[model samples]
Target chain A: MRDKVVTAAEALAEVRDGALVAFNFWGPGTPLHLMRALQERGVKDLTICTNNYTLRADVLREQGAVDAAILLPQTRKIIVAFSGVQQEDSSASVEIARRVQEGTLEIENVSHGLFIERLHAGAMHLGGIYSPIGIGTSLENGKEKRVINGVEYLFQEPIVPDLGLINAAKADTLGNLVCHGTARAANPVIAMASRYTVAEVFEVVEPGGLDPDTIVIPASFVDRIVRIPDDDPYSRERRVEQTLRSVKYRLEKMAEAEAEAAQGGGA
Target chain B: MKEKLTEELVAMRAAKELVPGDYCNLGIGIPLNCAAYAAEGVLLESENGVLGYGPVHDRESLDENIERVDWDIADAGMRYLEYVPGMSFFDMLTSFAMIRSGRLISILGGLQVSEKGDAAIHSTSKDDIASKIGGSMDLSWGAKRLIVTMTHCSKDGSPKIVRELTMPVTTRGRVNLIVTDMAVIEVTSSGLVLKEFAPGWTPEEIQEQTEATLTIAPDVREMEF
Candidate 1:
């Protein structure tokens, strides 16, 4: 069998223009290292699916942006479950809002549960699943709804992406992945659903270094692995900055709103 | 009139609804604070894939001991959480499976709730690209019990509990209970029933603040801690 571990560039070499890429981007599941490499690759007209669009815009407001979403200029649309601005005008978007206005971007809103279930179906090769989660909401729009056992359920379609960018805590030589803590989000599912999955791991060890019982993504599902260095700035330093910025913005916004409310009450 | 219920008080009142051994999930904003005031027995689930977590580290608490904040153990909201004895984490599939399968109860913040039990938590405008509908759509049906904790009115003094929701709906006709700043209302098969009110407010005053006409419960009394 071919070596599972490879350089980041080699692992991401197949990613081309117009590729359908999926990312495990919720909280610590984000494949930040690989996402940055892809952005530098300058791919275009791509359709990417992810959980959130930059975690409340802290990543997007900066010129560097964050995640693969920094590929906004080259990208065509984002199929996201949660993509929105925290503040309508200020601090939220210097990039996303412009794309929506130009008709260059489209947002496909979905329920969080059904979104993953759709991917679950994709990974398992199932036709679809009947869901009642968003039955009477906007998510029911343009979807086939059927009654099962006297309860209304909508049909959720499976989505298989061309490439998957996922993060795991560790990977062995055999390509098995171990994603610990809350970081174990959609990574395993993305590995199974995408045609070719690339994992960004903190470390790569010998085959037996990872406990077989704890491996979340098996070798057959993961195509390649790229280990992010322990001292990588993307791992901790950057998030600390982002978190501080987010906290400061939130506090300032709260203060402004409180001041406005006080003025209104006094009058 | 007495002091209006702060966000903390609204959360405290919602915390009263949590029972021992009940698996609960809280939305962002006012509902997230319920964890601080809630009893320890209830198992909390975060939608970004955590189950049976202990109290989360807040900015105020972390200000004293900043080292307690583990960036890796954060929820989807980026809040660092504490791990309890039997705390376990799973992928989003298992997380939502537990949610949609009615294994967890969801307490969420809201912008508007209709008399007919429709809730609009995510966005006020249907076409607003600036707001997101994260898991509220799924959380609305987490279980037979969906409790909404929010301010009685918007910051601009507009009534949020209304005859019909003018905002984008998260889910329709499924809100079971609403704990607001001024009143604790229940959604009965018949209509919205006002069960309790804050100390300085009467059912009449609460109704005045609400756009929807409220049916006062027979045993309606001042809200208790």
Candidate 2:
């Protein structure tokens, strides 16, 4: 078998400007090491396809050392289910808000199901999918609409990205991936949709180490693997710390909202 | 009603609407609370690919050993999810295929519901910043039944059950039922029908707050819970 293990920088070295990148931004499956490498590589005008764009910003904010400046400029457009300011107090990713206002960044806001389905179409080598989800909503603004069996369905084209970035719990030397708990989110689908899939894993074992049944993503779908060092800044412990910090930040925002409401009136 | 129903009570009432063996999708906010009140055999599904999820694992209730395993609690929608015996996880594609197939009943939080059954939940008129559009569109449009759970009025004393939505529509003519702090209403060809009101609240009182014309059910009574 070809050696798939590579450094984060080596794995991401080929990413170019204007490349479409499919990212797993759901929960802990976000490939922060690859993201950091991409930020440092300074590739510009990239289009990111992900579930939520604010998650990376949230993690950086919780870390308190870095800001959105590193990643915002790299992204020219984001096709996602959730984008923009999240709360009444402006608690969401500031970079997204700023870019959207400046008209520098474009957003194609589709429903979560459609977002996944689009990627799935790409992965499965299907031309497109017809669904009733976006029918009369803004999601169907420019999409082809078809009536099948007396039901309106919107035709969504496939989304094939140039690169796919994902994080996983473990990977065999051959690039078979095993996700931990709910962190598996969109990694498996993303792996199949991109031309090159780079997996950043916590551990890399021998070829026969990972159980076949436990491997959610096969080696055939992965092009490269980067093992995150135990003491790396983006290790599991660091992610947990960042998550807790984000929770604390959210609680604080909620408290502040409550205080402001109390000041307004009893109602 | 003498006092508005608590968020938990509103969720409890919404939970009662779910039948056994139903596949349900609960949105963020008030709908997330419904997991606690779910009926037997009602499996909760998340858009991120989890099924048969149980109620939130309160820190107090979680086993000490399990708490040590780092779980991403930043996403409030998934923070409270407890893995059950038959829990299964899949890719987002499969998760959404189940949703778009109209096999799941969606319980969602809404900003406004028009008499025509159109719902506006994604964006608000006051949003000068970028608008956030989550799974509201798909859940509303493709779910077998869309149940909207929200407070009757906004914080500024405006009725959410309006004749027409002032905000951008999330999905057109998709809402099946509207559950609020004051009343439970069903949207039908005739318009918003007042099915049940909270204790001490009359149809007239609910009508006073609702912008849409309400037709009181023939057997309208106080909510059982």
Candidate 3:
């Protein structure tokens, strides 16, 4: 069997300028190290499809955790699922808005499910999924619509990205992956949806070291595995602490609102 | 003459819809308070792919339910959660599958609801610089029953119950119920029916606040619990 484990820079070499990149951003499974690596690689004119377009980083930073913010110039276009959903006007989101206004970047916004379903279509090699998600809103524009079972549904097209950057808790030499918690999200799908898939993993084990039942992404779908450099085990612990702080912050705000309402006669 | 219901009360009213053994997803903002008031057996799901969990309010609760706590496992709103018994996690695709399959009842915070049951939970500016339509579309379209918990009026005090939606629509004719600060409106084919009003607020007062004409249910009464 070929050696699939390589350094982050070596794996990122496969990514070229103008590549259509895909990132699994819906959960803690985001390939943060790989994203930062790509930003360092300085690939230009890349069109990236992701769930959150740099919005997560800003939120994390506010909570005092160091988020891996990819500040790549000439990103060209971003096809995002959730943009400022929390109504958070983060610097990254603000920059995206500014870039759009400056005609420096283009963006395509789709609903969360359809975004994944479109990628699933490409991975499964099937016709695009017919979803009624955006049928009513302005999202109905320029899409093929059909009435299936007397209900109107829009046909979404498959999007096979040139490269998929994914994260995993562990990977074997043959590239079988194991993801932790909800972090398993999008890793399997992105591996199958992209032409070339590279993973940023916490650990690299020899083949057969991992039980077959434990592997989430099989070896065949993954092309390379890069163990995150200088991996700190305390990273998640710090983030958890920060999350608790934010929760306390929310509670404090709620109490203040309640106090204000009480003084205002519940108006 | 009387006070309006608080955001927490609106969420409490919405939580009544989540009986035991029901799977539920709550939107951000006021709807998030539904977690605190959810039925004991309710399985709370988040778009980030967690189910069978409850929101973690502070460190003490986290330590109490810390058996399988994955600190990295944050909810869609970026809130850390407590992993209760029977709690399991899945990927985003599977998470959304459950959402679009009519298994989860969603309580969402809406921007507006039309008389015809059309919901406009998402909004975007004309500049079209960036649009954020999260799981609102799927939830509104596929929830077993969609209940919107919001205030009756916008910050400017304009009615959110409207004759027609002027904002970006999320789903057409999908809202089953609306629990606002002033009243509980049932969206029917005929019109928006005023089912229950807050204490001291009458159907006529709600109708006056609403942009669309409200059809008062024959048995309308003051909201309880």
lDDT of 2: 0.80
By TM-score, who's the top model here? 1
DockQ of every model listed? 0.61, 0.51, 0.52
- For each candidate, C-alpha RMSD in Å? 2.6, 2.9, 3.5
Candidate 1: pairs in clash: A85-B130
Per-model CA lDDT versus the true structure = 0.82, 0.80, 0.80
For model 2, name the residue pairs that clash. B56-B80
What does candidate 3's lDDT look like per residue over B10-85, in tens digits?
Answer: 8888898888999999898888999899889999998878898875645446645544666667788766666567
lDDT at residue A49 of model 3 (Cα atoms): 87
DockQ of 1: 0.61
- Summarize candidate 1's per-residue lDDT along B177-199 as a digit string, tens digits: 99998999998888899999998
Superpose all Cα atoms of candidate 3 onto the true structure and report the RMSD in Å to 1 decimal: 3.5
Off by over 4 Å in 2: A55-69, A84-95, B59-67, B70-80, B126-131
lDDT of 2 by residue, B192-223 (tens): 99999998798999999999999999999898
Chain B TM-score of candidate 2 stands at 0.91
Clashes of each: 1, 1, 0
- Candidate 1 residue runs with Cα over 4 Å from true position: A55-65, A86-94, A236-267, B60-68
